[model samples]
Target: MTSAVTTDNSARPGYGQLLRTPGALGFVLPGFAARLPFGMLTISILLLVQHTTGSYGSAGIVAAVTGISMALSAPLMGILTDRFGQSAVLVPVVLAHAAAVGGLAALALADANVWFLALAAVPTGASVPQVGPMVRARWAARLEGSPLLPTAAAFESVTDEFTFVVGPVLATALCTGVHPAAGLVTEATLTLLGGLLFAARRASQPRTHAPSATGESRSFALSHPGLQVLILAFLGIGAVFGGMQVSLAAFSAEIGNPGANGLLYGVFAAGNMIAGIAMGAVAWKIGPRRRLILGYVGLTAAASVLWAANSVILLGALGLVVGLFIAPALITGYTMVEQLVPANARTEAFTWLTGSIAFGQAVAVILAGRLTDAHGSAYGFLVPMAATALALAVLLALRAKLAPKAPSRIVNASVSAPVSAAAPVSTSAGASAPGSEAAAGPRDRVNERGMGHRVPVTVD
Candidate 1:
């Protein structure tokens, strides 16, 4: 149970170890299916509404509504899952989501009013399953107290990159090649099937915490100072994604290659996937705050180059550079949220991260669309640059507060905590490190099943 903050891939478990965890695949495969629609929905809706209504402005509004709804609902769903367990909540939510998608498709096909389409987005977005957060929570629960936890987190980041790479392309192909309605229909079908399969995997489900145990007067997870900073920072990152999508789409259309947007984005995801896999396998000595700052720097620097991209080839090449920091940033954030809050608030805390990104993206799309529509695609890149700059500033200002405190020495401690590569190992008094029983108070050490576990100390 020794810590490996400075260890390389040779010292860590192989990628296979992530799947070898009991019941890992049962949740992961369906989770992937459920998440695929995230990539599809925004672009598909953008194209579909724009095509039918004859205006990108109308399409952007509807899409923005959908994204905002999804973002707003994330924390609520997280609370629900934390209180009642995943299966109990997922069944109803997923079915309702499928139904909403069906209605949205029918309305789009019938040339319904633009406001009517926006109305449909409310339920469609609200019903998005807590799949991403759930999958991460499941991994944390299963791998609780294991040194391999960070490795698992990295694997999940890679999975996310892969989904983004394929999901948007799939959406675009369905909307363009097959039929406009095809993308929405496929999204609904996949979500339903995946949600059902995920629900059936009882073995992999994480333990649930009753909200009442925290007492009615307890502060929400976001009330914590560090978590607040992280959420705000993530908002900037989300804006980066949202603004880039709009810019790429407009740029493609301007270049007489509207369909190339998905491929360009895929190039972006490919770079992220490659970097994410390697990031997960290696161990780091630097703390999470430093890594987070570095990621911000890299993302901003690479994204700044987009303003100069006049051709699709240049955009594709720059996409790879912009993607390099995404995985490191995301993986580190997830790992930190796991340790920053109490065990009971784990799911809800993660959902806050999701919601932050959603809100940021929602704002970005709305702003970027108008910017691109008024000026040109070239101006659209400015939105992400501003967003990343703000993020970097936030991290720099809060670097000391956000960094984990050094861990305290213990006499013959039984458990070693797992450390995310993005975060440094805490060794000071009251330091909060992942899976550290000493760092977590008595109530925080208990599992969802009302059982307490001892800390597994590392020999090294």
Candidate 2:
């Protein structure tokens, strides 16, 4: 049995090899930097709305609206990127985001109509996905089947940590010190710059899914027993995160130290980022399936601790402890998603996984806000914890009934992929020929029952 699977496309860069090369890290840094400003924008909006409107309730409404809109649009954008390519899709989206956000910033300064302000919010908010998940996808295929992939996951998570940590501090400072509008302007500028830089990156730019890639794989991704469980787990994860956002924000506000809340959120991200690194460094000797089960269970345990106490300090502390498990769990699940999905739908599969995360974050934010309004932030913790716990139990119960993760990689086909001057094949709603026929290149469908894209090893 092969210990590791290699992709059929030798031309594709491995994540491990890319990092080893000089300047590759530098190449990816801009994408990371682009996310920093927006982090501040999110919280600044929350604080600004609360202060200006004198309503934490209104702030929650705006926050929920923004988070949910982004969540709803993300998969669509992912699908667009998968269909149209990142450069084409994200460029226009980012530009629209810039205009919308800039309009909002200006509106904050001007006495703009309230309805107009809300109108602008939606499009600006939609712009967020430009630099986030899609950028991660760019590197995913580049680093497939290497230790670097986990390291890459860690790196991606770190950017998320940095964004939350830095963005909030800036938002808080600008809101209290200068003007709320300053934070908005700062966010607008940063998001525009980051989005532009990321979209412009030649390699990082999103590309359309090659047709013939997945003409036959949607059923597998949607109906495969293992995948179904994973998707449900992700849906629950979304609910947990959505709840966390509202709960954390409200909790911080109630304590009269909103700064502390940002710190707590930062710590939450930090724990995951750090753990993700360690998780990536060590190769799980166990199979991907076993790794996923352990990872999810760890997440359930870590997240549940928030319910034990409402003490701000304690929650923060527990949040960090819980966050420690998050990145690893996500990375493991992402890898599992890759393994479980058919290659034709790899982009969509990955999108589904990422979309689930965003969805979880969105729903959690909305629920947490409402729950905080009705009860308290502390109680909101139960929202995500309970949801995740239930999802886990259900997934576990059904795990055996679902197809097990293929113990070892399998390829029953004798196939060869073509190189240059690739022929283009169009696909339709129910087409399989395009994806199947195109399923041989670096663009080949991920083998659901296989480890990943496999290149047979020959012993001389």
Candidate 3:
């Protein structure tokens, strides 16, 4: 059986209709609030290190380490959350994360030796995962088939944009302001406050007595061919954006406009956020693979603008345009990942999906930093752009097999084995969307991880 969709019935919304029901509004706000701390933490790490250590080299290394910790932690945590429930697993990790960051702040400000500063980073860095993704995943399960989800996703994308865009600016302003310590303190406080609130929310938990027999089975993410392709795509996309983070900061600083880094990033997020909302209101029936190819192509074009731009304004404007594709690409990719995997291991699948981004980001930070240090930041954008082009070409060639051909695409292009409009689309072969009459009790399948006891893997 497929996951259930959450319906918000308060308002019968038309075009550009977002937050149709009170339930959706309820879900969306928590998702937004949950994201704030993590988003703030992401940029805060960069600013905090720079402010405390007084070295960009140190700052870059700390950021890279944080990425590594986050990548490592996300999948495992997601797996636990999937099986045991988010509250059972998420709360303690958040507590640990809060302690780590708060404790590290003391060390950082005390001018603890460089070694102590670096050492403290391990836990602090590992603490925050994209809480937004998990939050969105919950929303996905809650609001599956309803038109509300896409709109919810659109709002989620915008909130994410705000988080990344505004998060750093807010942190920077606070850190440099009268308090100077306010940034990290605020981040810590929110993580505690929000994480606790999330943990306490009854609706946040999935409605189930036991693991779906399918969910109870376990498997390694790598062996799944669809997951493999998704990971590769994630890595490439992650690399591109990761490079942008480092290169943008350095690029702005080089031009005697380091402060504009957040503004440019905000513009980039703005484009994606606005476009995401717009796309949400319509029917998006494109095959995941074709849409993916489109997204990569869009990114390539966006990067080209960056490589060719004459001014920061041009770069920011182009960034905004390119940003449009980011959310859609990611949303489509997550949907594909959910379809291909199984009833269990869904959380792990998403975790790896995110991990790929973090890994790519880490690699980008390390490699891009060195590249920027040697040549100008302008030269730094080349690698990720080329990588995106290559990744898109590969996915397109494999489109027919890994991703199902869309109903619309099959009609226009000759194809067999097309899923019809009336056909009940099973998550696997016979599964229907949640809240549908067609869905019945699930038949458990064998989930082999690498080949296990108590190994539950859902394709979410």
Q: Once model 3 is optimally superposed onto the true structure by TM-score, how far is the C-alpha of residue 150 displaced, in angstroms? A: 3.9
Clashes of each: 20, 21, 21
Better of 2 and 3 by TM-score: 3
TM-score of each: 0.84, 0.76, 0.80
User: In model 3, what is the error at residue 383, expressed in angstroms?
Assistant: 3.6
TM-score of candidate 1 against the unseen true structure = 0.84
lDDT ranking from best candidate downward:
1, 3, 2
Summing lDDT over every window of 10 consecutive residues in candidate 1, give the lowest-scoring window: 443-452
Q: Candidate 3's residue-wise lDDT over 1-460, tens digit each?
A: 1111112222333333545443555545665666677666656766777788888788777767878888888887777766677777668877888788887778878977666766787788677744665666665565433334445555666676677776777787787774546787888877777777776665745542244666655555456787778877888778877878887877898889878887887777778777766655655544446666788788777776577665898888877777887777766677665446543565677788888888887888788889888998877776577667766776777665465322222122111222223333343433346653234321111111110111222221
lDDT of 1 by residue, 1-460 (tens): 2234333223445478678766888888888888887777777888788878888788888889999999999999998888889999999998999999899888987999999999999999889887888898898777654445667778888887777767777887998899987888888888888888888887778777754654744336776667788898899889888888889989999999888987887788888888889877775655556677888889889888788998888999998888877778877888766556655677888889988999999999988888898999888889988898888898888765664332232201112443333333344544546674444533222211111122222211
Candidate lDDT (C-alpha), each: 0.76, 0.61, 0.65
lDDT of 3: 0.65
Identify the runs in model 2 with alpha carbons over 4 angstroms from their true place. 1-18, 21-23, 108-116, 204-207, 210-228, 252-259, 310-313, 342-344, 398-460
Better of 1 and 2 by lDDT: 1
